[model samples]
Target chain A: MIELYESQRAMRNMRRAAMQRGVVAILDVGSSKIACLVLRFDGSDPSDENIGSLAGQSGFRVIGAATTRSRGVKFGEISSMGETERAIRTAVQAAQKMAGIRVDHVIACFSGAGPRSYGLAGTVDVMGVTVDEQDVARVLSACDVPDFGHGREVLHAQPVNFALDHRSGLSDPRGQIGNELACDMHMLTVDAQAIQNIAHCVKRCDLELAGLASSSYAAGVAALVEDEQELGAACIDMGGGSTGVSIFMKKHMIFSDAVRMGGDHVTSDISMGLQVPTATAERIKTFYGGVVATGMDDREMIEKGGETGDWEHDRRTVSRAELIGIMRPRVEEILEEVRACLDAAGFDHLPSQQIVLTGGASQIPGLDGLASRILGHQVRLGRPLRVHGLPQAATGPGFAGAVGLSLFAAHPQDEWWDFEIPVDKYPARSFKRAVQWFRDNW
Target chain B: MQPLSRKSQSARHDPAPSRLKYRFERLKLTPGFRFCIRVVLPFALSVGAVSLWFASDDNRLAFNQMISEVRETVESRPEFQVKLMAVDGATSIVAEDIRKILPVDFPVSSFDLDLGKMHETVVALSAVRDATVRVRQGGILQVEVVERVPKVLRRGDRGLELLDETGAFVRLANARADYAKLPVIAGDGAHDAVKEALALYAVTGPLKARLRGFERMGARRWDVVLDHGQRILLPETKAVRALERTIAMDQAIQMLGRDLTVVDLRLTQRPTIRMGEDAVQAMRSSNTIKAGGE
Candidate 1:
């Protein structure tokens, strides 16, 4: 828990340095690929005077981008520190070369480590004066920090909503006349070891770790349209080794969770079922993958060429329908797990139920349709918003995490560190406030 | 005992609906609408105040005057005062011209100086192609300018002025003799057509010494006036190519030196030449003798 506070402070300091430098790198370390994007800031402080108009929109532009096949990473967690460091170095170096500027600060996002979310509420008397930053800080400090067991730490503790004087859902309450101030904060915690491993990996690459965000939150920020974010939406990022699910409302990620299964599971299924190599299975999946099969698929034959000299095995062909059959069950299981996560998040309680699917694995045809049927929400396929000077090849769902990290680097949400947490007020366990928050929001 | 037990059950069931009704009544004012009121009411109040203030002339004047006074105090800080101005990326003459055009007062507060307006004023100078004005460290106002490079010298009714490559007015020439190396153009609107004249002069590389100037004809075409009072009329379109053809013909036939007053290449396919008056009369008399002999 102390480490959480330290990491938050370090991240804030690093973010300030990156902003001063006018350029920073955004890295997405996933199971299948490590992507890096170099963003150039135009020196406009995002918090300058237009807080109401430019709430969630960022002002950074991508100047360079590069990606490489990930090594020593599985389920979005670093398995081999040395291998992951090498991959990150390669990606960042390539991106820096393209951008013609070397960057020492990087903000990285990953998905894995059994993300858990807790909602906490805090309230305080405004001392009969107009509410200001200090009051907001006092209220935030009053929120009870839940006992998230051992070996886990908070990744994101953001004030999702604020209420003043019995009125709720206030975005910002400063400069307003209020006698009482209340806040609902969403805290996401992940495995401490996973975060430490990533920090170590980034340090090994000789770059300062500026910030860290959950890949699901970053993807949702990048892919979900403004209305979807404002009303309510969920972004399900299906990567190679993990599926990240995040729920957003009012431009804030209120809940996030991840399932340790992704496209690699389907590829492994195909590899085992067809007795083919993983590379061949991946090729076949990318070229001919689908969740839904039709009668026409039965007539379409996919050649399964083998390196062995055995004529019978090398010359064999299988119907596309058979491939679809092998892939659908695993895909359905992943979606079912995602649905369970969403149900646990009380997604149906939100006013809007739009779900956006994005990530390298989400590129599979018919996934949106299948997701809509399974998740019982309006589903849409999402790709990252095109940033300035981004290459044509980099404008794909695979780069959503990288692009989203860039946006996060530019215009990070006002987090707990952004405010001065009043040191005198310690968190007190108040069960009544928690229940009241739940009732009000849900 | 049975009647008493039945009475307890009936009493317990009777308040259930009323309790539900109480809960519904409590929930009538949703947090969302309350939040809306909380945000909208203050915003609307401020807007109303502003509109009312703007609607009344006296109030508006008082408000604006108060704002200006506050701004003046904040801007008059010693750190915000610009003590010096430095000009870069221009010659001494052009820089002097830029200084004259800019409306900045020396040692004035930086806030009082509208940098955007200053930039526009500097760029409006004939010599300045682009300019950037910024407050540098140490309260120094830095003005960086890209001065236009003169490509041609045009003699106009307003005297000689230098023209850049794009035929835009640059600055008044200090002396015509100083820019003698540059090709000179004259006549109305020739300043705008300096580009075509320059191109024609470029292709006539061998005839540079004999070429004097270009006269813009009807503000459309060019009449290439040479040193020996000989002129070549060039068409508007492809005037460069026509000049090139004339140069080629001159190199082949020495057509320019053959006592001709005008060479018309307007119809590029058939060039017509008007001989000198004396030369035309000599040819006519010689033609009569040749007819008698036939």
Candidate 2:
């Protein structure tokens, strides 16, 4: 617990330092690729005038961006520190060279780590005056931290809502006269070792780790529109090694989970089913991967060339329907896992059940229709928002995590560290408020 | 414990009907259509991309050339080129400065010019309060600027700077002589409190000839210094009312014309006056002489 607090404090100081330096790097380390974006801050805080709309417009610009094939990473987690560090260095160095400047601070996002969300509530008596910064801090401290078992650490602790007396949903409770001040905070916890490994990997790349966020949350921030973010939406980032799911409401991520199966599984299945090389299987999958098969597929044939020294065997072809048969079950399984995660998150209770599919694997032609049927929600394919100077290749759904990481670096949502928590009120194990928080929010 | 178990089971089973309905609705999509939409089309598109990749010897080069050509044609249109720039709502000197800092090349495509960045660059100038940049008809890049109006000439550690009505620095002046017509203020933070100084100056309009300048005391309140060596200490808040009262008292009793060194209006309830050494000596001698005469 003490280690968790120390890590949070260190991250906060690093974030402040990054903002002061006027330039920072956003690194998205995934199984398929490692992307780096150099963001130049104009030293203006994101104003509350437009709120959710245009939040990412005025604060930062992407001066440089670069992506390289990832190595030694599997399921969005660093499998080999040395290899991942080399890949990160390559990506970051290219971006820095293009940006014509060196950045020491970097904020990274990944899709693994088994993220879990908890809703915590806290209430405190306003210090007899208007609700001030100290009062808000005290209330945050008053929220009970749940026992998330061993080897787990908190990633994001955000104040999602504030209530002053009987007035609920106050975005900010400062300067308001109230006898009681209460807050609803969303806390996301992940495996501690997963974060430490990434931190160690980044340190090896000679960059300071300023912050960390789940890639699913980052994708939600990037792909969903303002209305989707406010009204409630689910973002499913289908990547090479894993599929990440996150739920957003009022522009804050309330729930997040990830499935270990991803597009790589589908490729592996195809390779095994067709007796082809992994590279050839990936190429065929990208060109012909679909969950639905039609009569036309049976007529359309794909040449399966091989270099086994048998000319006749090398020139053999297979019907596209056979390929579809190999791919559909894995994609369906991944969606079913996503649906289970969403159900566990109580996603149906939200006012809007819009599901946005993003990331590289989501480019499949009819995944949205299949996902809509399976997830029982209105589904749409999402790509990263257009950012200035972004290369054409980096505009695809594959770069959603990277683009969202840039936005997160520019205008980070207010977190627990931004407040001065009262020293006297350590987090208590009050299960009552936790239950009440779930009742009030869910 | 039995009741709790029953409640949990009930909660888990509650969504069965909705789940059945959803499944039934999804079953409406026939297998053939689903297979076509999901599998066949995606396979065809991927095969097409693969064929395009394998067909040409310089596929990447061709693609790059095509993209560049399309971009060039779109950007090179005459309507997109900014032939000239016209700066409005500024003096010739300020307009020249605006042009110097803009860093834009003539006959460049307007699409290449980031108007928001240009506006920020123009607003960074000390003389500009705000600026708006737009492309007009006939390939003209029009820039409209609102210049900060200088209200006071402040002489501080950084030398003389013109201050706006809000006490913000507008621009630097070479010397106080250049802006001698404007009211002068000195000391730290005087540039930020030009509003109060201007208000005091307004109230002392009748005595403008005798007023030399205003000095900021400790970055709070003000000291109105007169040419005849009289200093009026104004309170931090409601200094205008105090200045008005002082002016009224001076008009009623000729208080300012007397040889008073300081008028302390910091305590508004009871105003105190400090006499000059010579005036005190003269009063003392007159009182003694009157005592001797009696």
Candidate 3:
């Protein structure tokens, strides 16, 4: 835990250096595509300061953006280092060209890596009459870190709640009269090997990994609105090889997990059913893929074009209803897995169980209708929030991960600080001041 | 089942740039590198090329030759040519002297003419007081000379020379008879006091018939010399007034017509005259006879 903590702190320092230089690159490495956005910070807003409606971002402009199809990546994990490096080079080089600048520091997000969330509680007696930062630190260090397996590393550890004496939910216990201080912290851990792979790939591309974020948490920060996050909401980010589920309450992410199944599975299912190539399967799915099938879909046929020597084989077509039939089950299976994770996390107990569906795969027609039936009643499709200088093509739901990574770059500690936890050095507060961690950090 | 993904994907080259190409492009995009290429490189190249071209002696000589040839062609044009020189407002003798001093041949380019130097050369002639040299229309080099009018003649060691009113030498006079009507001033510093001499001459109204010239005495005072050898020695300051007093005494006593040869007005309270030898002998013989009779 100490080792990862120091590395995260170093990455935070690199991010601060990038902010001082006034330029940073955001990379969202997903299985389907790698997106890069170069942002130029034009003002001196406080680091991790909630300056805008979305909590902790202000005075930044997107100067360059590019996306390339990902290679040698599956379920958001780098499968081949060399291939991932080349893909990253392609995106970064294109973005640098558009921005006409050189970028050395990068903040990246990924959706795979098997993230696990843990809730921990620790108590400490106040050393002085009133609790101060030292007592807060002591209580935080006192938290019993669970043995969350050997190979995993803690990505986020935050003090979620603080209680003094008998009163509970004292978000900031510093300088308050209290005899004993007890705190609850949320810790999210992911496979260490996955992070190492990402860091190595970024280094190979001549970039320094300034910060790392789980794409699910980034997606949750982007897709879930301010009110939904404050009340209670779960963000579902369905990508090519994985679907990310993240629950936010009182503006802090409590749990984040990824299901190892996504749009690629549905495309494969269609490819197998129609005896077509994967490329053709993807095109057909985007054109005719749906979750709810009707009688009208049977009449809508999609031609699967091919240049094979035999005419009879090249001209085969599939009805839209048949395509929907092949896609619906895989998408349902992915949602069912999400529902299970939410149920396991006790998502039903939240005050507002808003489920926001976003990402490339969420663009399927009638997805919200299907997700509402299985996930809960309050379900809607979401696109990433708008930012300055974003290209119209990148504002789609597919770029939620990339946009969220940019927001993460604007405030690097938002993902690593465990906002629900109240720590001093890494304070990215969601309910800060208990009054105005209002849009990002209070 | 037909599968054409491989053929289509293989038809086009990979969209991702190679590692070397990407690095090269990033270097190209760098602000410092871009500035080197965009501004400094071209400036340095052009300057180098120019300096290299100018390095050879033959090239330098050829450039200078081209410039001189262009200048010559423009200068030799008809509009710039001076066909002749015209000397205006001078006597024919003075004009001839002026034309002799100026050696400008006809049909020379006006650009070759140094008017300022030419004017100074013409004005330096004793006969010409002030002159202007200019190239007027119709290819004429016009020299307008203002010749000084001779006011007095000075009989000096180098012979008599005509002088203007300001005591400047106008020209050499061959003989005194050539200018018999002009007053003759003779003495070492008489020319230096021409204005005073002219003032004394202005008061010599009654003695005009007998007046030869006014001679400067000791370069300070004046001695009025008449044709009969009568001379009046006048005081230094207010010599003109002393000369007026002499003229007044001569008008009252007709003293200039007597045997008096010297009227010494150097001492204003005492009036003394030196007679001729015959007059002094006659006065002494008459006084001796009158004493013997008494």
- Residue-level lDDT tens digits of model 3 in B71-146: 9999999999999989999999999998898998888999999999999999999988999899899999999989
TM-scores of the candidates are 0.57, 0.57, 0.83
Worst 10 residues of 1 chain A by lDDT: A423-432
lDDT of 1 by residue, B162-215 (tens): 899888998788787899889888887887787788888788788888988888
Residue A364 displacement in candidate 2 (angstroms): 0.5
Worst lDDT run of 10 residues, candidate 2 chain A, spans A423-432
Error of 3 at A203 (Å): 2.3
Best DockQ goes to which candidate?
3
Model 2: per-residue Cα lDDT over A77-122, one tens digit each: 8887766776787787778767867777899999998888999999
What local lDDT score does residue B229 receive in model 2, on the 0 to 100 scale? 91
How much of the true A–B contact set does each candidate keep?
A: 0.00, 0.00, 0.83
**Docking class of predicted structure 3:** medium
User: At residue A434, what lDDT does model 3 achieve?
Assistant: 42
lDDT of each: 0.85, 0.86, 0.86
Pairs in clash, predicted candidate 1: none
RMSD of each: 36.0, 32.9, 6.7
Question: What is the C-alpha lDDT profile of model 2 across B66-103, one tens digit per residue?
Answer: 99999999999987899999999998889999999988
